[model samples]
Target: MTGFAQLLDQLPLRFLLASAGCLAAGLGVWGATALLRRLPGVALQRSTWLLGQATVLACFLVILLPHSERLRLVPPIDVADMAPSRAAAPQGPTARPAVGGAPAAAVPGADPASWLTLVAQAWLLAYLLGFGHAVLRLLLARRMLDSLAATGSRLPCPGQPARAPVVIEVDAPISPMLFGLLKPRLLLPQHLRGFDAAQQQLIVEHELMHWRRRDLQWLSVGIVLQTLLWFNPFMRMLRSSLSWAQELGCDRDVLRSRSPAQRKAYAAALVAQLRLQHATPKTALAFGGVCASTLAARIALIREPSPAHPRRARVVRILAIAALACVFAASLAFQPALARRSAPTATQAPFSCTVMVDAASGEQLAREGHCDERVTPASTFNIPVALMGFDSGILKDARAPVLPFKTGYPSYNASWRADTDPSSWLQNSVLWYAQQVTTGLGAARFHEYVQRFDYGNRDVGGDPGKDNGTTQSWVGSSLRISPLEQVSFLRKVANRDLPLSAHAYDMTTRIMPKRTLANGWEVVGKTGTAPGLGRDGNDDATRQYGWYVGWAKKGQRTVVFARLVLDAKQESAMGGARAREAMLRQLTARLDVL
Candidate 1:
């Protein structure tokens, strides 16, 4: 899927996580206010505003976090997790290489993760539609507000000085309101123009209090959050609460030091401004928004303002602060998804390395420990030897020019007792077949090929003039290659970037043993095993050295892989075969099975 689609698919998870944050912040602020019923209006107002801010902030946090591919809230499906479609296959290293069938199905919808797609794409599509509609509604409201603002005069109030905020005297029947963002404005209906200067002073002060507190900017934040989280009911609740708190706080601030007679005048002014609250944009922090019920509440509060409860207010403030901290923690903890990278492998082997890469881009697809360390290529070197044999016209086809096994040849594997061809030579790991091919190439030519290919140190001169370079250089001897180099070499071969002949490439690919996975992926590879294959520190024979190298493909895409494992002691299974089996299980879990 495209990056945009992936983001869309993740939206549901992000919204859910944000919702968790909103719930926590609401519980914190709302609960605190409930407990301290008589908390100061301004103090409670700030906390309520924070409650709204915290909800949106949590959503932003979730959106800003980096995407995780491997690890997600939903884990990718594994073959083992699938419902069996047929009889279970035998489990072991000895299983046939190319057995095929859809052994399993998607476990009747148990898994939610997509290998290269998202399960939540549908939810994202719906969310975008809702979000877009909300934004369009807001834009229309803004346009309406701008048009309404244009209908009023931009002159100062009759009695107010020339330097006061620009007063707009509108003939419309709206309440006195605070408007304008860049240049503050006090909006007054024409009916209020005849009020005494003292009453007008109280109205101006109330609107100015909103401007001084930067309430418009806070309102803008609420409008934006409403658009983004259009489906979140808590956001709607928070927005309403924020506006209510702002007005209450402004009223308290306006009448704080005024005499009882002045408070009575302010209450009377609020009653008069309740003419009509229509044509007001949701984005505006209008002082005239109070309905008859809200006006009654405002007048009640004005007649008998909340008494100072210093101790109770302090305790409420502390509780609000603690709630904020809890909200932040909950929001961060509820991130939509997390990366689940392949953990470091725990192995009985003292040393291990595994590396894989994308053939076309050369991007490192997967990795284990650092793959740069070099050691003997062991029997794994036969793959290169076979390629050289084919290129030099020393070897023919997959099943041609059968070469008999020598009496003294290493036949540790009983399967290597008979005459061998390219196919069986690799499958049975016949040492004689590999030596014959290498001996035919000779030392100088073999060394030249290794150097040209940049395979390891390319020092095929043997163990200090042992005159055995052709036979023993890669046999726990001089020649060495790292897992990184092995994967790089294979990637070049797959891309046909190597200097080998087409015939050679074709033959080598044909001869390599491959296993067919249930999902139609073909895993082709070679295994190498030897005793004391290390040159410097790891030369102990009891410590078996193993290597599994090759690639897997499903159509045009391929993944090249190389792995080396050094065990502390000899295992019942040949180290190379065991490594290949274990590696298959690991890759199968990823559904990449190389």
Candidate 2:
């Protein structure tokens, strides 16, 4: 996937849209079902109604299934490498070069190259499955609609039928809407509209109120979603509840203009219409998705005094909200502590591979392996270089442009096959540019800078008295400070104890990538790349490590350290992917950043 697409996949918009649609459709279907079942002598059972409702939802969901694609990284794999050879083939007679060139000699022990084909194949399979499901659902919905259209008849009116009220007429005998908001369509039989004007007016007013509120539209949207994600029972309940609330709201509105006596009359009119119409309206809106008991309860509610909604319910709701908030806060507070508790004990912690000493106090907080590991110091060594450069007159200004240079010096790990400008080299992590800056600073000066700052292990090799230069071993030559030491150096840099000016420090820090953790903490850090670390010669599988030496802050700055290892063969892409995940999890557990 493209970088932009990958980024979008991580966002929550797709989930939000799907959830909202499902809720709306569910509520609408429930309201319509309730209204249909309330009608007298309606033969359809709630089970049948629910089945049809689900079918309708499934069909709508199929149409909207295209929006929910997510992107994820896949691990890298190796493939055999085949190279062509150029030497002339041995032959007694003169032989022309073979077609498509002769096969080249293979490297004795080299592994194959890495490819990302696995993820691509998986994505293809998922896409095909989703597409097939959507097509099948759409066809099923079309078939159901066709069958309904063939068997159902519209309510006949005096002249051309006027758009009276919006409803989802069901196979029920009810005249009043059962619910309000979600898909509040009106239901009627073949000749139900021929009822007396007064009776028709009352029914029309109720359903019209629902239509005006746009309940049906929201219901349709929700049903589509429910069909797609039917497994979530909680979502289903929410849909049903919302539909009930919608119907109640419509009833209140319809009754507002009518007197208590008029409402009673309206209820009576509904009964008369039910008796006159032999068959219930099946065009969605006839309301009444419930049984006789619910119908009796609604009628009773209408006949009895209109009881005001209790204030206790509101108080209970407030308390519920408060309780939820408290639970959320408690969870947030507990996660980090739980993480720490679950973490391995101090004795199980990795040995100090490198000792981290506070620059200001010269204090060591953690240690790793027994032997002092020597690393090439990678870009991290640049901090001291910049500092010493500022101290000496040679660098002169901290703002001096990194100049271009060319060289072909070979190094222990990477070959300086060709050279470029100093700035370009540093920008691209070119060994030659980095070495020149290191060399220009002089061995004594570089050693002094290392000692003055306590940036890392001070032994530069050779005698302790002598200002020895770098190590000879390729692995040993790499900048090898552990995560703890890296953070210690950064803490000092952030404190600005070194002679380097603020401009120099800020410039260096600004170059690092900005990563915002879930817990609202922000970190910035630089990355490093080295070759020959992996079995493959290609850079794709090369060994990679990074020092995310940065500060974490909610609103103010608090220094923090993060180190990452990269390998194309693991954690999908480069090692940064794994490192980022670990750091993000830690940050999230510690603070609710997002």
Candidate 3:
């Protein structure tokens, strides 16, 4: 169950919807074909088939057409206590006086420009998709005609007997042939003879099967839709689905007037044709043969009067319809921006290290750096650290102090410094303070918070060098984190659903230092300096790493960012501070005009 949920969460929205759409289309074609097969009488059945198809085509067009353009009204509230007097509601009373005897203005309806723009975009997309499919159908028909002509088969004159004017001309090689409207053509090479009387009848019957049901036209339409929506896997599935339906529909059509023996002979003829025309062109439809699996199905249908038994066929049809209906219902029932609220408009407040989440409708706002290459995060790691502290009781309040002294390896030769405080140390990104907090939280409590976040790391207070962390002077080893992970952690922090109390969270957020720009706006962030890893200075003596991350909320935009200077030496570990400033300069410049 957990794995299933994870898989669903990981799936892209496009893939999920496409899968459902494909299934719906396949089931639609299948159920329609099956229904056509069950009907009795060749002429009556074919008429019904054509009628039902035309009805479906009409319905599809209705869906494609633009809906009525109507203004959506905001429903009026029946505020009984605040309801205006009936006389005043519909008509203007004598001009009302303000405290100074001035008349106040009435509120006007908001501008509809944004809504209109969205509506136009939707209509444009629908129009493009619809016209694209139509163009593809024309192309498919043209190609089919060309493929048939290349095979050198001639179309028998219309209204002639099924096998009239049958000639085995020595001047022309015999080729395969298919008869159907919408570019109907034949396939015959430069050197083959006509089949005997019985074989010719069966072949002609099979081709007529396609014509009777207009299977070629449906195939062309389905092919066009598939081509237009090529990115959708469901569209790809529709091709095979409609292809199967067309063949099945034709098979049943052929069965309607033929004896069981005649059916088997026809199936045999199809197989023979497929073998004879081994070089079947992709552009042409060959009446005599097809895919091996399709051929096998036809043969099986010949042997069994009801290949899909009546009862089973009905069950399959019902199941397919029910599943398809469920998918369509579910898709249509959805409201927009369900995952997150619609993000604040460009005019709303902004976040630094900006996580553009829509708090109202859950729509994610578009932003920069979404396409930037990934980078390893350094001390921005502490955001999650602070989160763990808040979630668990250990390292409880932001205001509470835990000023401890140093006696570790890097400071072994130096006297113990006793003035270490959590608030100040955290603000300064002191490594020793972070380690002390981690130790105070205890292994069991620490693991609990780690599990909750599922940050993909499993180390429980292991040596930094041994795990994903690198060795640092003040803190023995520190864990590695990615910039993306840092932004994610900050989101949870800002959301205030983590372990800390509302007050503590507010205080910590408030006390965090902010770097003020030339303009009035200030940016809040934290900085980290640590020993570096891998190819470092001689014996790793001077290796260092630096990190800074925080959010900046400007009008309507809250940008959260993380910066890192990995594998540096000495004071260069503080390079992240300068990098953060540069990044902010570029970002703010873009936001200022907006």
Per-model CA lDDT versus the true structure? 0.66, 0.43, 0.44
lDDT comparison, 1 vs 2, better candidate:
1
Location of the lowest summed lDDT over 10 successive residues in candidate 1: 339-348
RMSD to the true structure for each prediction, in A, is 17.3, 20.8, 21.5
Best by lDDT: 1
- Pick the TM-score winner: 1
Best to worst by lDDT, what's the order? 1, 3, 2
- What is the Cα-based TM-score of model 2? 0.35
User: What is the per-residue lDDT of model 2 for residues 229-341, given as tens digits with 9 covering 90 to 100?
Assistant: 55445445544544554555556667775677777876676556545543322223343433344556556655653544446445434443343343333322221100001
For model 2, the superposed segments whose C-alpha errors exceed 4 Å read 1-187, 191-198, 217-229, 256-285, 291-293, 309-594
Ranking by TM-score: 1, 3, 2
| Count of backbone clashes, every candidate in sequence | 1, 67, 41
